[model samples]
Target: MKRFFIGLTIVIILGLFVGTGYFLYQKSEEPPIIYETDTPFKTDIIKKTIATGSIVPRKEVALKSQVSGVVEKLYLEEGAQVKIGDLVAKIKIIPNVVALNNAQAQLQTAKINFDNSEKELKRQKELFDEKVISEFDYNQFLLDFNLRKQEVEAAENNLELIKEGSSQKTGNVSNLVRSTVNGMILDIPVKEGTFIIESNTFNEGTSIASVADMSEMIFEGKVDESEVGKINVGMDLSLSVGAIEGVIFNAKLEFISPKGESDEGAIKFDIKAAVDLKEEYFLRAGYSATADIILQKASDVLAIKESNLIFEGDDIFVEVRTGEQQFERRQVKTGLSDGINIQIAEGLTEEEVIKKL
Candidate 1:
C-alpha cells in the first residue's frame, strides 16, 4: 500500500511540472509593443469660436410721443426719413371743460379791467393836455393803460389755447409733434385720430414717434459668461447679419455689461458692438447677427498636432522617430494651439517625426 501511495505522488508532481513549463513557454511567445510615429511639418492652424445672434443697429433710438389728444393726422409712416423740426404727427386737442371754463373767466375779468383802465387813461390825457394835470401823472396813466391792454391780450391768448391746442399767433388748432432729431421713422404708434396722452410729470403719455439715426447702427447681442471675460473693449469682430444675405460687416466690441443676467438658468453677459458698415447693406434695427471676435492670432508659427503631446510633471513630451523602426521619448515646448495643432516653440524640429501614442 505504501509503495502504491508513493507512486501516485510522483505522477501528480510530474503533471504539475509539465503545466508550469507550458505556462512559461506561452509567456515567452508574446511580441514587444511598437509605438506609431508621425512626421511634424508646416501646417496652418486657426482656432475660432462660433456664436449665434441677430444683427441690430448699433445706435437705435426708441421714439415716444407725449400728448393727450386725438391723433388728427400722421404725415409720415415707417421707413420715412425725417429731419429736425419736421412734422411727424398732428394731435387734435379736445378742450377739457374744466380748463376751458377757467380760461374764459380769466379773460372776462381781464376785459372788464381793460375798459376801466382805458376810461381812466382818456380822462388823464385830457387833463394833461388842458394843463390840469402834470406830465408825470399823465405818463403814469398811460403806463397803466398799456399794462392792462397787454394783460387783456395775454388772457385772450391763454383762453384760445385752452379751447384749442394752438392760438392764432401760434398758427393753428393742430399741435404739430415735430421730430426732435434727424433720423428715419422706425415706427408709428398712433394712427390718424388715435387719441394719445401727452407725457406729463405724473405719467408717461402715448408714444407718437419712434425715430432713430438709421445711418448709425449698433450690434446688440449676448455672450456666454465664460467668453465675456476674455473679450475687451476695442476687440476686432466680423459679423454676419441674417437679414441681408451673404454679407459680412466688420465691428468692434464697445460695451460689456459688468452684471450678468440669468438666462435659462445660465449666466450670460450682454454685449454691444459697433459695426463698421463699409458694405452699406440695409441693416434694419433689431436684425439678428452672429459675431466672430478675433481675440488673438499668430501667423507663420511653429506648430504640431496637439494630440501627439503628452504631459509629465512640469514637462511636456512626445515620442519622435529616432530611426526607421525606433522611437524615443522626446521633451517639447509648446505654444498657442488652435486645438488641432499646437505651436511647437521648442524640443522638436520641423523635420522630426512624433509618435502619436
Candidate 2:
C-alpha cells in the first residue's frame, strides 16, 4: 500500500510540473507588430504662424471738454451712431468767484467811462452847433464817445460769458459738445453732474466720449520677433475673433513696426492689418482676435505627415515599406511645411507606402 501511494504522489508532481511548463511556453509567444502605413497624396500645404491681437478702429477720436464744467446733459449714449457736427454732450460751466467778480467790475468801470464820454460828446456837439467849436473837434469827441460805448458792450458780454457757460452773443454753441468726425460712439466715461476739467497747459483734460468709424476697422496685433522678420507689409491674413465664432475675416497687412517691444520676456513687433468689414456683421472695437499669417504655400503638391520623416543628422529620411512588414530608409528632399504635413520635393513616389513610425 505504501509503494502504491509513493507512485501516485510522483505522478501528481510530474503532471503539475508539465502543466506549468506549457503555460510558460504559451505566454512567451506575442503577436507580431503589423506596422501601419500611409501613402503620399496631393494637397495644399501652407506654412503659417499665429499672432495674438485685438480688432480696433483705424480712425478713433477721443472727444474732450474745452471748458471746466459739469456734464449737464448727454445727447448720445454708447453705441449711438453720429455724423459730423452732431451734438454729443452739453457742459454747464461752473464759474469761479474771482473771475466773475473781475468781469463784473470791468463791466461797471466801462459803463462809468461811457457815461462821462457821452456827457463830453453832448457838450462838444452843442458847442459845434453854436459855432463855438470846429467841426473836426466835435467829430473827434463823438468818435471817443462811440468807442467808449462799444467797450462797455464788449465788457458786458465778457461778464455774461464768465457768469454763464453760454452767452447771448455766442448762443448755445459754446456749451453744446459736437462730434468732430462721423462715427459711432464707443464710450462715454462721464455721466450727468460729473465735474470735468478743460484741456489746458496743465492737463490733458477729461475725455467725455470716444467715437470711431466702424466701417473701417483694423486688426492690431503683435508677433514674436523671430517671426516678424519673415512677414512683410501687404501680406494677406486670415483672422478669427474669439467672441464671434466659426467665421474667418480677410485682411491685408498694412503696417509693421520697425522697433520691437518686450512683452512678458518675449520681444514682439506690432503689426496692423486693414480688416475688410462685412455690412452684415459689425465688428466692435477691441475684439480679441488671432491672425494666421501665411509665410509660404504650395498647392497640389505631394506631401506626407511630418511625423513619418525621421531626422538623420542634417538630412531628413523616411521609412518606405518595400514588402510585407518590411521598410527601407529613403532620403527625401523637402519644401514648405505647415508644421503638420510637409511637402515631399524629391526622392519619393506617391505610389510608395511609408511606415507611420
Candidate 3:
C-alpha cells in the first residue's frame, strides 16, 4: 500500500510539470498577422478647401437722413419692399437755435433794404415820367429795386427751410428720408422720437434704415492664406448654409483680396462669390454658411484610400500585393485628393491589390 501511494504521487507531479510546459510554450508562440488588402477603384476625387462665412447682399445701401431731426414717423419696417424714391421715414426738423436766429435776422434786414429801394424807385419813376430824370438813370434805380426784392425772397426761403425743412419754391422736403435704391428694407435702425444726425461732409451720420437688393446676393468669406494662393476669380464654389439643411447653393468667385488680414493670430484673405439664387429659396442676409472651394478634380479615375499611402522624405509609396500574404513597396504619383480618397496618377492599376496601412 505504501508503494502504491508513492507511485500515485509521482504520477501527479509528472502531470503537473507537463501542463505548465504546454502553457508556457503556447504563450511564447504568437499568432501569425494577416494584413487587410484593398484594390484601386474608379471614383471622382475633388481637392477642396473649406471656408467659413455668411451670405450677404451684394448691393446694400444705408438710408440716412438728409437733415438732422427727430423721427416723427416710419413709413416702412424691416423686410418691406421698396422702390426708388419711396418714403422710408419722416423726420421732424429740430432747428438749431443759433441758425434760426441768424435766418430771422437776415430776413428782417432784407425786408428793410427792399422797402428803402421801393421808395427810391417810386420817386425816380415819377421824375422820369415828368422828364426830370433821364431814362438810363431811372433804369438803374429799377434794377436796384428788383435786386432788393430778389434778396428778400431768398431770405424768406432760407428762413422757411430752417424752420420747416422745406419751402414752397423747392417743393421738396429734405426731412423726408427716401429709399435711394429699389430693394427690400433690411433694417429700420431708428424709431419714432429718435434723434438722428444728417449725413454730411463732416459726419457719416446715423443710418435710419438699411435697404438691399435681395435678388443679388454674394457669399462673403475668409480663407486661410495657405489655400488662397490656389484659388482665383471665376472658380466655382459650393455653399452649405447652417440654418438650411440638405441644401447646397452654387456660386462663382468674383473677388479676392490682394492683401491679407490677421484674424485670431491667423492670416486670412477675404473672398467674395456671386451666388446663383434659386427662386424657391429666399436667402436672408447674414445666413451663416460654409464654402467648399475646389482646387482640383479628377473624374472617373483610379483612386485609392488616402490611409493606404505611405510617405517618406520627398517621395510617396504604396504596398502592392505581389502574391498571397505578400506585399512590395511601389512608388506612386498622386493627383487630386478630397482628403479621403486620392487619385492614383501612376504606378497603380485597378486590378492590382494593395495592403491597407
**Candidate 3 TM-score versus the reference:** 0.92
Better of 1 and 2 by lDDT: 2
Task: Tell me the lDDT of candidate 1.
Answer: 0.79
Best model number under TM-score:
2
Kindly give the stretch of ten consecutive residues in candidate 1 with the minimal lDDT sum. 58-67
Q: Provide the TM-score for each candidate, comma-separated.
A: 0.75, 0.94, 0.92
Model 2 TM-score on a 0 to 1 scale: 0.94
lDDT of 1 by residue, 197-227 (tens): 7777887778887888867777777788878
Residues 1-357 of candidate 3 have per-residue lDDT tens digits of: 999999999999999999999999999999999999999999988889999999999999999988998999998889999999999999999899999999999999999999999999999999999999999999999999999999999999999999899999988799999999999999987899999999999999999999999999999999999999999999999999998899999999999999999999999999999999989999999999999998887899999999999999989999999988999999999988888999999999999999988
lDDT of 2 at 30: 96
The residue pairs found clashing in candidate 2 are none
lDDT of 2 by residue, 189-257 (tens): 999999998887899989999999989999999999989989999999999999889999999999999
Q: Model 3: residues >4 Å from true position, as ranges?
A: 311-316, 322-324
Looking at model 2, which ten-residue stretch has the lowest summed lDDT?
A: 165-174
Candidate models: Cα lDDT each:
0.79, 0.91, 0.95
State the lDDT at 245 in candidate 3: 91
Off by over 4 Å in 2: 1-7, 29-31, 170-172
RMSD of each: 7.0, 1.9, 2.1
